[model samples]
Target: MLQTDDLTRYCDDHRQEALEELEAWLRIPSISADGAYRADVRRAAEHAAARMLALGMQRADVLESKGHPVIYGEWLGAPGKPTALVYGHYDVQPVDPLDLWASPPFEPQVRDGHLFARGAVDDKGQVVMHWEAFAAHLRTRKSLPLNLKYVIEGEEEIGSPNFDDFVARHRDLLACDVVIISDTPVFSEDVPSLTIAVRGLVNWEVHVDGPMLGDQHSGLFGGAIDNPINALAHIVAKLKDEHGRITVPGFYDDVRELEPAERAEIAALPFDETAEAKRLGVPQLHGERGYTPLERMWWRPTLDCNGIWGGYQGEGSKTIIPA
Candidate 1:
């Protein structure tokens, strides 16, 4: 049996090596949304499976999916211990507007005690922390506090298209006493928090096609037809009220209201509106009335257009109305 001091030393010795391996793994461009990077995404998944096996997972494999592959691993040595399912994503967001990045998105860099990379905080870093914890336990001959299973999907950034189905199909394989996800932020830097509830999401794209069959002369057809761009703007403007409440019918019908004590608890959190505003580099904050910024971010539901474009987007002026 390994002693606690031996395990501590092992973790200290291997921490830097583990971080370097993480950086190498992050270098793979696993953008699942882009068809061109499909192979890279699979490569990343396979790499993750291998790493899990090396970390003492009894069964580790890339579970094929219609989209990207899912890396599954489990260490079930502790027979009587409770099982915990840990979920994370290996896929990353597409780095469009590449010029915005100070460094290449896939090139992990450490500066001032923080790692800057595409998947650093979003998921990879968080997932690696748990792996490190497991490695420490193993090195010390200390079994984990619970049976652990890792489900790292490769399409979370793309709405996790296959996740629900995979989970349903593998109910027995994924059975666990508790599910732990590290995708959320803590309440404060000093106070760690465990999230018990997650807000569900619904996404829709409103594509407005222009009336013109093709680009037409603006001088001739500009006033004759209702511009789709203008119509889209008007439609979006009608989605919210002056008080920032969504105008969609029945939008708030099922929304739950916080009790007086809950409201008080939320208000009691340490926050500075002015400091937050300064941090965001905004003159002031705006949101639904009667709620604090924390409440608005965590508890409130919101509606806003993620992207809108209808006119000529290229450089220089074009007098043609695009269809």
Candidate 2:
């Protein structure tokens, strides 16, 4: 059986070939948000299953889902050891504003020692890393230290509409002692870290209905009518104050304050706010008041309107009170 050193040597020797395989997988335009790329999403799932089988997984197959398919793979030879369910996604977010891309979003490119692709970092790249590690163990050692089961889905980019149902139906099939996920970020390129906890999300959609049946002429009903768009803007503005404190009542009541040790741990991490701000091309940092950027990002609960639309949007002026 091969040792860790042997596996490391094998990986180092085949690094270029691994990169080529990753690039090939990255070429699939599996944008789950758009129905146009539904087939492409399935193709990505099939590719993942094929790769799992090639990596010597005892079982590798694509499972049906209400939305996009899920690829399940397992190697359960290590009896009595803890089973780890590896979770990852193959689907990617839609690439919009195509002109902004340095290269085609589907075409993976290496620039400045960074791989550039839509799902490269968010999930698919990390998924492939797990594959490589597992391959090393199976190919050289001929067995794993512990059982591993992978559940790579293709609808994560679309808010995982069918994921809950899928999980509910596959409870026994996915039973595991712990879950291993690589869908989060490290502190920085220099610091390889694991995320302990992640902030939960709650989404809401508020609608503003005007008296008019649809958009009305501004000349006829400008000041008299209450525009839904204007009302929405007012409501969104009231969510947070100028100081960046959320003004919504009871919004922070359940927000658990960070322990002193947790705060210290976060502070000890290498961070340069100035450099981060510069990298993001922002004039300065802004977020929930009285919290560090990292704290707000990793722990705080914040609200922002993702989308709001009900008005004329054209080159020429079409003044109207949108309904």
Candidate 3:
């Protein structure tokens, strides 16, 4: 058996090579949101599976889904060790407004100690880190502390539409003692954190239609009929209160309160309210009046109007009430 020191040294020596491999992976334009890059996304999934197979995953393959594919790999040689399922996503967000990027989105670049690429921090970097860890263990004959199974999906940036179904269908295959994920960032450069919980989300789009007519003269019909735009604005305004608490019916009945110690620990965390406000380019911070910003973000449930539109938004103002 190889010693731990030998494994550590091996990891150190091959750090550059691992990083280069990550750069190559990042160079693939696997934007799942765009239909044009569907092939690129599949290529990325295959590339990831190939890398895992090379790193000693006995069984590694790309599983097809209704959308993009999911790459699965496992090394279960150790009989007594617990199993851990590692989850990550290879798909990336669409690089719209491409001009905003310093370099092309698919061209990896290192600048000022940071890797600049579309999927660098979003997931590819973190997923590659696991591969590096596995390689280090295998090269030095240092058996993994626990058996690991990798599942890399290609539709996370698009809200992981097919993941829940896949998980349900393959529950037996994916059974593990725990799930390991490295997608979230550390609390700070010096503070590493393990997220204990993730907030659930409910997304919706609202559409309001005015009268049957197309565009009516505001002067002639504005006072006689209800304006859909005005109604939508009113509905949005009623969603919150002066205390920043959501006003949705039954929204808070199920909300659990934080323990006193938990609140104290959160308060003690390194934070500057003024700095946070500045970072957000806001004059003041607002959220559930009693909780800190971090608390509101992580623990409290929120209702936000992601987008709203009903009437004309072109150049100058038109004198017509949209219908």
Candidate 4:
């Protein structure tokens, strides 16, 4: 086994270079969710492939998927050892509400010893961590202890629509004994935690159309009909009850009940409810009534409206009904 001090020192030696390269990669606004940023997303994929090639990977390429590209790299120098695949995403979420940001979303900043950037935590940072680790290993020992393969994608921010098909087609290329993921965080900085489950995602886009032939005056049609925005609001509200239980039938049908030991383990976790609320800037805590905050966060299923769009959004209120 490698000494922890030796590994720590090796990482420290390359930390600055790692930060610089990560900041350069982060500068590309790879917002896969927005069609306008398609070129930027492609650039991010190219960057990942290039980084892998620089790290002395045997084969590295940005293969075309039905949607954005998939970056694949491999280093199989170690024989008679287990092979591992590392999966990550180079694409980042759209940085909206620009006004609220203290620094430009794509520009990297170092303040208070933390790297400030759009994809810093949610994943460019994690990808860079993997990059630096492998780079250091290669530089120090000139070879890895075990064979490694990488399959980083560029359409993760959006629902990875074509990734399943792409993976199925390349099953032989992606075959591995195990896969490592770096997107989610451990429980806390000091606490060593491994995520065991991934919640399934179901996205719905609801468009409520009312009698707004362009911009109708609210004054004339106010009481005559139900506004689309109002109707949507009601529909969204009915999805969940006052006690935070989902009103949709069969929503919890497939959820496996936590065992008594599992519940006990969760209950014993060190968590401060008030500190969590304050960290989120919420006045108080609220969620599914029966479960504790930690349980609700990690174990319970939930329904949430991610984005909602309705009428006039401008500097001041426009009195016209929006479509």
Candidate 5:
């Protein structure tokens, strides 16, 4: 049996080594969204597989896919024990608007004890934690209590475009008693939160067309012709009311209400709206009127416009009605 105390001590003693490993992995800009970073993405996968193999995991390899490859590793020594599939991703979202960053996204930096990198939290860091935990167990106790399998994919940032098919093809290999996903947010820095469920999402690319055949002089056609940008603004503005409820007909008809037990559990969590607002650098918080902040975040549905543009977006504004 693995002694929890010993494992914790081993991890604490080798914290610097763990940080170094994570920093090395973070240096690779494995962005799945852009085709230009394909080689870098593969490099990241190879790096993960190498770590898994070094840590005594069996069959550690970068398995190919139509898109970015998936890294697989397993330690199935404990017979008749529950198999836990540890899922995470090596690929990170594109670092656009790079000018806003204090340091380079790929160059991992430790600032005030916090690691700053592209994949620091939103998954690579968590992936490293799993590997390091396994390392600690193997180094100290020589074996794990239960079977373990790793499925670190490289296309997760791209909405996991290739994950479903990869799983379908390798059903037996990926089978497990329970899957553990570390790619989630904790409630806060001090609180360790386990999120059982997440809200679903739907995306649509809405386009608005103007009456003009092409761009026209806004000064001349401002009042005569309707501007697509103006029309789009109106449409987006009407998506939600002042109370933060969606204006769409029958939008909340299928939404499930929180049970009494669930509400109680949520209420038990420590939260301060004022502190959170201050931490977020906002004067106040806003959400659906009826639900608390936690309830609104965890259960309620929300609609947001991610990107919108219909006019000139350069240094100087072009005085034209976009078509």
Candidate 6:
């Protein structure tokens, strides 16, 4: 077993080198969404695979998916001990509205203790943290206590379009006891925490088409047919009630009810309803009848109308039945 003191000493000595490596990685523009950056995305994947090889992993290979590539690395010497599979993405969000950035997104900088970059947090930085930590343990203790595997993908920013097929095709290669995701922030700097649950996503775009042809004057056909915008508004309003509970039937069937202890723990968190209301410009707070605001945010499922549009959105009003 490796001593804690040895681990600490190794990290302290190699910390600066680790930071430099992270900065170099941050320089790569691995934007998976845009086809132009596909080569850069592959380079990022190759860089991760190279690190795995350098860290003495038994197998380090870059697997090509239909879209952006995936890198898998493993050190499976410890037969009896449990194996850990780590997952992270090397791809970053597309940087648009370029003028808004105080510094270039790809050129990482450290100012007042925080690293500034596009992929620094979600999640090249997180991936590098895992890599450097493994390097330190190897550099100091010469071995990890258990078998470990890493799977860094380059398509997460685009919703991992080919990940399901990739995993199915290589199921045997990725078999492990537990999987860890390193894509989210720590709960707080002081009170370190692990996330046990997160809501699943279902994405879709709603387009409410009304008239068969183009725009007609509202005065001409106001009462002749149903207003698509009004219909959409009605549908959206019925999605939740005054108490904020989702109106969709059977939505709560799979929802795991939090125990009393869990509720108490959530309630103890620092909160001021009035202050939050003021900050949000909300007159008052509202949510599912029984749970506190914290529980609603953390555990409860929610529905939001992210985007909606139907007719003219210009300087002034143009009263027309737009399709």
Which candidate leads the pack in lDDT? 5
As for candidate 6, its clashing pairs are: none
Q: What is the C-alpha RMSD of each candidate to the true structure, in Å?
A: 2.2, 2.0, 2.5, 1.6, 1.8, 3.1
Better of 2 and 3 by lDDT: 2
Residues 169-283, model 3: lDDT tens digits = 7888899999999888677788767888877777888887787868788888988988889889999999999899998889999999999988887887898889989998999
lDDT, residue 249, candidate 3: 85
Checking candidate 5 for backbone clashes, the offending pairs are: none
Provide the lDDT at 229 for model 2: 85
On lDDT, the stronger of 4 and 5 is 5
All candidates' TM-scores?
Answer: 0.95, 0.94, 0.90, 0.95, 0.95, 0.85
Error of 6 at 83 (Å): 1.4
Off by over 4 Å in 6: 96-100, 217-227, 270-286, 310-320
lDDT of 5 at 92: 94
What lDDT score belongs to each candidate, Candidate 1 first? Answer: 0.86, 0.89, 0.88, 0.87, 0.91, 0.87
Winner of 2 and 5 under lDDT: 5
Error of 2 at 27 (Å): 1.5
lDDT, candidate 2, 169-270, per-residue tens: 999999999999899888887898889987666677888887657778889988987888888899999989998889989998988999989999999999
Clashes of each: 0, 0, 0, 0, 0, 0
Give the Cα RMSD of candidate 1. 2.2
Put down candidate 5 lDDT per residue, 45-70, tens digits, no spaces: 99989988988887798998889999
Give residue 216's error in model 3 in angstroms: 3.2
lDDT of 6 by residue, 228-311 (tens): 898899999999998898999998999898999999887776678888789899998788998888788789988888678878
lDDT string, candidate 4, 141-243, tens digits: 7988889999999988888898999999999999999999988868788888888877767898999997746767898878777788989999999999999
List the candidate 4 regions with Cα displacement exceeding 4 Å: 212-215, 321-323
The candidates, ranked best first by TM-score, are 4, 1, 5, 2, 3, 6
